[model samples]
Target: MTMATYKQIESLMGTGPPAGAKQMQVMRWASKNPPKDPNASFSGKNVLITGSNTGIGLQAAIKFAALDAAKVILAVRSPAKGEEAKQKIIAATKRESAAVIVMQLDMSSFESVKTFAVQIQAQVDRLDVAVLNAGIAPPKYATEKTGWESALQVNVLSTALLAILLVPMLKDTAAKAGRPSQLTITGSFACQYVQPDELKLSPGEKLLEKMTSPEHFNVEKSYGQIKLLTQYVMKGLVDDYSYDVNGQVDVAIDVACPGYCSTDLGRDFPWYIALPTKLMHLYCARTAEEGSRSLVSGTLLGNAGHGKFWTNDVFTDPGIMVTSDEGKKLQRQAWKEISDICKQKMG
Candidate 1:
């Protein structure tokens, strides 16, 4: 294997299951801790982070600003909240007024994602980093404007559509800037918790119907399946653009997991689930800033980290389902299906 590939596999193998006490200690340590900034200056760079109104997305925006990115766009669902976040990032970084811009984007709707893309492409001359950080964990089964389960719509469908639209923009920026460009999507380690059977949707079956049926709908498993399927999508991206001309990928795409963080991701869930999750966050979860380090590192790692899955700032294999023979075949199949749907449904 290539050195980078070997490193990835080695990292995965080295991460054996955590011991109970050690895991607890890690959690307790993360409780209110924020990651220290790497202090990598951005100079002339422009960054776009979705769902930046709060949580890790917001902190990633702050880091990009603190590093001196010329422009940082907060692509959030609420312009008001985005503007509010913009003020905080500016004050935190002591950057200029135009350092952060607010734009509206709702991940549950393909139309909104499209409009956001068009607006950014029109306004921003370059996109050095595009962090697709907005996603949800549904508390119950619910369909969205995209006619899929809420988690699938926001986490998979709309995310893929945004990537489809933004990858070319990143390529253009890379060519112009004479440096690597990054499209980092916020992923979850929850993929490891997915049961094999949870990923068993047949290729030709109606995925939304089968996966989101209320009679059998499961919030945790649904989130897990969406995350597991996302690995296939990531594999497809790496394989599709594995080759780069002139020794650098035009655009480097990767996924990073923030570990468990205190974010609004569980906002849609019921009290019982949300309350325990909050308590866990209060006691064991990484502060949103600490979680955001993976997001920032994933964005800035450039070509060495291309098309890899990263967590805790290191490249690693996505998991067993992304490595097995059967899983690889299914990944291709799932990518074809997802791509076809994007062609049909997106603006």
Candidate 2:
């Protein structure tokens, strides 16, 4: 068998079935119940969720509130919409009005993310759970003010910046509580389907630079590649940055994939793209509330889930592109490129 065929077989037998088989497995996934832990409690913990104004993020916020998190910070690009979400969570859970805080966080802008981090530093002493859930899948290619592609800026750079900036708080909280804190980034199952051919690179051409170029933009492909990079960033943080002064891991970093949820993530898709997605959603997609279970459950994993992927109430392999030798080399390159961008932006 060819190497590509071997990889596909390995994926099917051990890791997961290939993405072309996703439709066939949809019924199984849809029929499978989401997880619930009656004993799970976040009574005094502060849970922060970006993009909490709608969809899976909003549902996760509601779940956190219902579970009695002391504070649920809804960090969104729009404070007004966030307030509406807060009211909804309060009304649903009957939690105190003061338990939910709406904070502004514009992931498209690095400056906005920095200001929001400063506000977070001033507001809380210990952050127990932070879900970096904000992301975009624009059908059109665009660049943010930082001159990076829009998805690269929002989904990767800003996500990394916010995670690193919050590390001190996570570590401090973990040290005080004597348990590792949770840091879960919203990832996607699409990353698994990223073909090796799509990632072919010329010698000396950096992965991030090639992916972000306008000439090579394809929304679906880029989205998968970006999510693959998200996994890399999560792994890099777990391997290098999440330890405390004592050399023990103080924060658990993992990626949560809310499988094929019926969210507005493809709101801007062209007719050709949107139609098939709509059909798929009609037939197979989970509700936002159902999908949010992965996000809430992932935070409950703590240290066991560091550098792992959580979905459908189980820890599964991320993908071939995230696990193969070729992937390791590319992940190192991507991590370096992302860290450099983050350092410059943070400085």
Candidate 3:
């Protein structure tokens, strides 16, 4: 039998298959060849992370608390789980009075997202960094609480809605502070695996309905399609976030990937896929702590990071296909149509 490395497996089955090896090449490189130094503290900053109950988000909360952040809000589907995660973070960091708190946020629901944003506006004086990190990978037939496919609701629609709601808050904060505030959408390597055929539909009233139909359901392709659509939302709306409601550039908005990490995002994996995946997680996946470092580093970038896709602690091409001339044309066309749909659908 041929032994499987990350790349070898990807070559055989596009991005993820055999339900194991979720592309560890970037993470393996990041782990073995770590960065030169620790990026510095987030002291006095009010940082918020969605899905902070476990995995990379949990690690990020710990580090920000250790750095003496004024507030570390855990935005999660369950306040109970968020509180539990907060306790663990306090125990790990021993940062008593870190002001780490749990705020309920169900990313699959538009109502929940709006309420969370309003609560932020009411309570927090400033938001130094907002990390949009919650996401899901559903089984072929899974659906979110909102009735859309699980990947579509949790990963794209609700997440984008929350980002749009938070824009003014980030902008107002940037305007108040000399430095620009940050809004980072946790991105994925899945963005690299898309093809034009996957999104070749012309602008039409029913395009979203057509694309998301169960008839198009293919387990292997669903997750990547969600990530690709997410990138489009990031690219399409990032510019708007850069400028405030007054149209002055006061915030930095970008997407960041933590590479492949062992996380609960794959909670929906079937037993067969899940069993072998445990082995791959042990050998290939970056520990959540290691992955979280990449995400936290993104909040520290300057103007160079505006509207860019960041990974491995650097701003680099999200994909060849996403940046090519033809790609640019496609992105623009997709953005024009999708933006309108997103506004209408999200409303």
Candidate 4:
């Protein structure tokens, strides 16, 4: 690739569009020449992936099944869709019965989240990898039943609650098997590029109004803020709590970005923008298989000393934009606010 093209790809990687355009070009080139051994196996593991019915989540589920995971739980919103995704995986991997099981989960509802957690606790003795992969990137603003913004609740709050509820089962299973459990949250590069001021919704404001507000009008920024919040929560969970009374550490939590790939995530954007975005992704975005590399690395390939973030099978900085003093302060505040909201809702 020419220097200009390389710069474009890098800019796209950083800001999702023009700013990271060079990085994006490089990523496109890299995808064309992916590593020969992209199919790392995970035999004998029990894995759960939220939103496993479509897009990146579905791809991740298929990859895990191909790796021979003992059980690949498809935690999804629709049973029919979940079954369809499961069938697709089985056919693709040629796995036998019981390779993938569909479980009902609606991240938008706190009750639904708790119910899913309880069901999981009863049915599974251990969870080797929990991929918090389900998320929404709505073009128009929306709110859940609880009146919280849709993106925030689904992308950040629900994910954190699921981890909190499932942490014990993960800990118990890991302890018995004498292994370290792993939790991976799928974040986005938007986290670093978007401005923080656009994240909050005014009290009692309509979702659409909030979406159009001068301060919070940008869809890309809103999505990025939610992701930044996710990384904050993931990091805080592993670092804040002391060793358990029994002196056992909690499961390791790591965050990763898939960069940008061709997926239904941006389907709701205006047609003019969405069309070009889709075309660009088709030509440049990493294949679903390649997009999942950092996620898998953060989970199974991570080591004792591995830091919180991973990309392309290596520990790389999340960059000054995401790790700066101001950024860290915002992250800290976001965690506390989310925790408080969760306590009130989950109570």
Candidate 5:
């Protein structure tokens, strides 16, 4: 593991869930107050959001459009649905049809992600904000065509790939706009719930390799673990590439947690799991629109939010795994593995 600076290590210490934090989060959810709509305007700015066809992504697209963004690109796996979502955003915002563009983006496939990136490069002049919100919570173990576990593939692998690919465009836009461009990746509080023992591995066994191995898959634990890996990727991006030649931030990269919103993310859950989750949603989950506020606010944080995790309208600790000694080692290992995969795939 690479040596992290003392400041970096200190930043993570004591930041995140204390003892019995998960229970406290659930209690807060029942009375969870929605974020006040940000007064910050995106007028004339172009924005893009993946998985915008449904859930918080769709709701977030509506918010961006209503805020007067020049263009709100809905990048989804299904164009037909993307178009439907476009209409919804337009109707909600009273924005013109031309204000929202639907683009195909299959997070399950690297080729598809690459194609989407190329399309963005070819068509858009400048992207002021991008929210990589496409992800899944599969109840059963499954692999995409890439042979990686579905959650790991979309939530961590392709997400890392897309973020890195979009950096140059974000940097270019920041230079022209005289403000840092925002690239917010959707993350979750679940990231903090994962325990070190849960991820115990054999000697020299790579964390990602073990997590993605079908023989070792654990549906109940996979989502949190994958989200944790996504946090690692976000940190790696900020540490390695977000700065300019003069050390000023070029792109403001950060993670946004939607706060366990009531969305279709659990639609595929087995009855056993789905029943409890639905009940929990009814009891405590935030509305999809309410959850989306974090994504919008996250993008507007500018340089102050770089490399930080934003949740519930404020920046907070990402959890112990992101700060502890053993966890930092895992963070380095996960970043090395994920970055290598992204580079190979991008090549």
Candidate 6:
């Protein structure tokens, strides 16, 4: 293994026992287990997966192509990398005409997001499943073009914006097709764990300092906070638009945690931290193909329970932090703040 990979795995193994025991158990179960339905497919489905150039996103795209999606839009930041990923999928599936298309989207930029949405609106009449899969983990400390904290911007704010912009299209598609359209957000177990009070950073505060100085300053907790906000926003969307007066669209919004898979998401950690993480990833981590199962289940297969959190086909409660009354209020406040930011930037 590369030194970076080795170090991540080593640190994870050395961190006493696993801090995420529940997550570990779910991973083990998924690793040894197979999907309940082996012959599932998504024939004639239209799927849009963001950040699909590598890691879990790439794997999910491949799966969608193999399952016979009518069109799989590989929404990615890097056009070159997206092309490479498309070729890999074509080679693996031997389906040259799988209708895989690449669209540019940098979730960190609201302008990019608006351009992407406009492109989709022009090209496609409706989107069956809009999978919000692209995300950046906690960067050392940075801000986006709009001066919002990077993690919150990329992980929470951008995701909510895209969903909002696409809802009308999704609803239109579902209305015409006579099926329930879906919005699946790939959340993390962290959402349930992070404290709600620290959802956003005050102006000029370093992102890393804000994250680590909080009483629960662990990496996972910070990450979880973002995920929690995503889920809460998702629930809010479902409540607001899942149905019309007569329940026309029935747009289902749900979240799922892809149990930590072996991906390059943690490549920047120190050697002590990165090595053990790599090992655990190798030994215990689910393949990206497997990781996409919950996502596909929630989005395409209609396996998601309405507004619930899922992993490996089972419905599990989100973090205690999110389920509490305080958590819900914080989620609302965060959403409004993000919406205001988007409005100002777009205007």
lDDT of 1: 0.76
Query: Can you give the lDDT of residue 1 in candidate 6?
Result: 33
lDDT of 5 by residue, 75-175 (tens): 99999999899988888989999899999999999999999999998878889899999999988889899989899999999999999899999889989
Model 3, runs deviating above 4 Å? 1-31, 34-37, 202-207, 244-248, 333-338, 345-347
lDDT of 3: 0.73
Clash totals in order: 0, 0, 0, 20, 0, 20
Comparison by TM-score, 3 against 6, better one: 3
TM-score of model 4 relative to the true fold? 0.84
The reply for model 2, stretches above 4 Å from the true place, is 1-23, 26-28, 35-39
TM-score of every model? 0.88, 0.91, 0.85, 0.84, 0.92, 0.83
Root-mean-square deviation of candidate 5: 5.5
lDDT of each: 0.76, 0.85, 0.73, 0.71, 0.85, 0.72
List, residue by residue over 203-316, the lDDT tens digit for candidate 2: 999887887899878976899989998999998888778887777778989998877788998998999999998988877788888888778877876666778997666577
Where does candidate 4 have its weakest 10-residue lDDT segment? 9-18
- Residue-level lDDT of model 1, residues 24-131, one tens digit each, is 564564444443345566788999999898998998899999988999999998899998998999889899888888999999888898888889999999988888
Which prediction has the highest TM-score against the true structure?
5
Model 6 C-alpha lDDT per residue in residues 1-347, reported as the tens digit of each score? 35653443233221122345665675665566633322346677788999899987898888888888788899999999999999998988877654888889999888999999999988766698888999877535556776666777787778878888888888888777777787888987666556545555566544334443435344545676667778767776776667856955467788866776778887777788788888887667877777776677666434235687766556667876567886676656655665666567657
TM-score of 5: 0.92
**How far is 109's C-alpha from truth in model 6 (Å)?**
0.4
Runs of candidate 5 exceeding 4 Å displacement: 1-30
Which segments of candidate 4 are over 4 A away from where they belong?
1-26, 33-40, 195-217, 241-249, 304-307
Among all windows of 10 consecutive residues in model 1, the one with the lowest summed lDDT is 9-18
